[model samples]
Target: MTSTVLTGISELWTLDPALDDPARPGDVADAQVLRYAAVVIEEGRIAWTGPAADAPAADAREDLGGRAVLPGWVDSHSHLVFDGDRAAEFEARMAGRSYSAGGIAVTTDATRAAADARLRDLVRDRIAEAVAGGTTCLETKTGYGLTVADELRAAQLLDALIAEGALDEATFLGAHLVPREFDGEDGRPGAAQYVDLVAGEMLAAVAEHVRWIDVFCEDGAFDPEQSAQVLRAGAAAGLGLRVHGHQLGRSGGVALAAALGAASVDHVNHLAAEDVEALAATAARPTAPGDRPGLLAVDAGPTVATVLPACDLSTRAPLAPARELLDAGAAVAIASNCNPGTSYTSAMSFCVTTAVLQMHLSLGEAVRAATRGGALALRRGDVGHLGVGARADLHVLDAPAAIHLAYRPGMPMTHRVWRHGQEQPLAPVPPTPTP
Candidate 1:
């Protein structure tokens, strides 16, 4: 493999785990954030990173014109396997109607009606949009397809993308909600029967294609008990656990995620003090060694509190307590939750900006959460940081400093991108709406 030395980097936020302070592993100290840096990429991995002056010889060299470089954003929670838009529902919510989980049923109907080839094309277009905004690693879920065949097809599509190197992780979310036909009003199966179907036949079919399983643990979705049943079934199927928790109310999802050792619990807009404490406790749990190649470790660790900023804003809901989660020693990640019903954009830069500005996180904290925190959420060690021996994923910004992500929010900042040492062809990025 040809080696290249990248120079003229004004600031390089490697966020290398080796340079992290053991006393505060979550903190992004200055040591890991280098200035006037140079990096060497070889064989689709980071060979070295240091001062530009001390850079060593390489097969080729490139200058970034004093721009900032950071590890590409790792978006760990999204729903991208759907086929329709909810612009009318969003307009209704903006016009005084409250958001509810029921809107998911609308997307489910449309997704079930989409052709297999059309669904694949939709997901490809969405992934391209995410990459245009500097998202290099993404995890999307299969929840819109509520039936056994549809869910299995979504999983198969995602698995093929993984093989083609277009996607990272796939999650089975058969427990996202009970299908409308299973309302139990007539002779149809009720929510309980639907949960059984998901935990039994549906999971058995899609388990091999997905790396993790998720359940919507909230009112109007599945309760904690039903969520637990589905999650335990997923665990028995040899898949990692994730949860869609606490977006609307003080649901018991937080405690359940902590008790069950879920890898992540997303949409934590309403969290109690005890909920924060329970999630923080998971930070001290033992994690599997970080040597696995292209696979998320399915063992025990903290349940990452993944805050979806765009979803919260679009739904007119309270922003997640990201600042408090960090202060309480819990690992926190920022994801786009890109879906039709709520957040429709795949702009991870916008999510990071919201974390810094509205959520009271410092720019470093926000960037780290969107990158490394997302990696931890998925229990994957290889892609979040630009550490030595890590994947050569780079996000070169047009600005000279990283602070411009929030300093000049809503601007196009992605200058170029690289995934595994290959430069990606970027599309015209859409500007984020100013908050």
Candidate 2:
């Protein structure tokens, strides 16, 4: 394949893994920044990155007009396979009603009712929207389809997209909530039976299509013990563990995740000081490499505290304690948590801006959380940084510096994007309905 040399970059935030110092702990510092830089891309990998003056000759050369560049955003939590909008529920929440996990059933009905082709179209559109905004690597879950058949369909759809390189990670979240039918009233089986299905038959059917499994460990959903049951089942099936934890209260998701060696625990809106310490403690554990293809190392890595800023804002919930997590030596990631009931936009830039302006993270910290932090949460090392041999995923910005992401908040700053060495069309997608 022919190589391309990209020049005229005013600032390049390489975030090269090679520059990460073990002594600094969770700091992704400005030491990795390079000025007057250029990059060489060959065979969809970064062949070289350094001063523009020392750039070697290549098959093609393009100037970026002094714009800034960074690794494409890696969003590690989202729900894009579903087929409906929850604008009505959102409006209710904004009009003084509180958010609840019950809203998940509304989405489940619509997603289950959608035709296979329609659901595929909807998910593809959402992925395109995310890419247009510079999200190159994203992980989506299959929680909207509560039934065995519906969940299997969603998983298969995401698996196909992964095969085609249109998506990155797929997770099985069959324990999202107990569907209305399983409420256990008037002869219906209760949450216990539902949990059994998730840990047994449902998991058996979709386990081949997904790499990770997640449970909503909160009130009105699976309790701590039930969540543990499901996570253990997935682990037995050779899947990495993830958790939808502590979003609405002081749930036991953090303790459970750390104990089970889960890769990530998202929506941490209600963490306690002890919960922070538990996650930080996991950072010192040595990671074991995955023995199978298409799966993460299930037995290792820190339980990343994935803060969903957009979801917190839309639900009127307290922002996650991202600052404290980082300060305490715990790993942290920023994600959109894009879903129908709460967060509906796949804009990682907006999430990063919120992390900086509201969550008290510095620009570098926020960007790193949204990119490298996310990659670590998913246990994938190749896409988060622009190090040598990393995927050629570049997010070229309209501004000269990355700080403009927050300084010029809400402005359209994505000048261009390239994923895996090929340019992506930034066609405007319809504005995702907000809560």
Model 2, 223-315: lDDT tens digits are 999999999999999899999999999889999999999999999889889999999998888766666442347668888999999999999
Task: Give every collision pair in model 2.
Answer: none
- The local distance difference test score of each candidate is 0.91, 0.92
| lDDT digits (tens) for residues 1-435 of candidate 1 | 699999999999999988877666666889988899999999989999999999999999999999999999999999999877889999999999998999999999888988887788788888989998999999999999899999999999999999899999999999988998898887888999999999999999999999999999999999999999999999999899999999999889999898988999999999999999999989888777644574456757889999999999999999999999999999999999999888998899999999889999999889889999999998878888999998889999999999999999999999999998989999764532212
Task: Please give the TM-score that candidate 1 achieves against the real structure.
Answer: 0.97
Quote each prediction's TM-score: 0.97, 0.97
For all candidates, the clash counts are 0, 0
The positional error of residue 329 in candidate 1, measured at the CA in angstroms, is 0.6
Model 1 global lDDT (CA atoms, 0 to 1) = 0.91
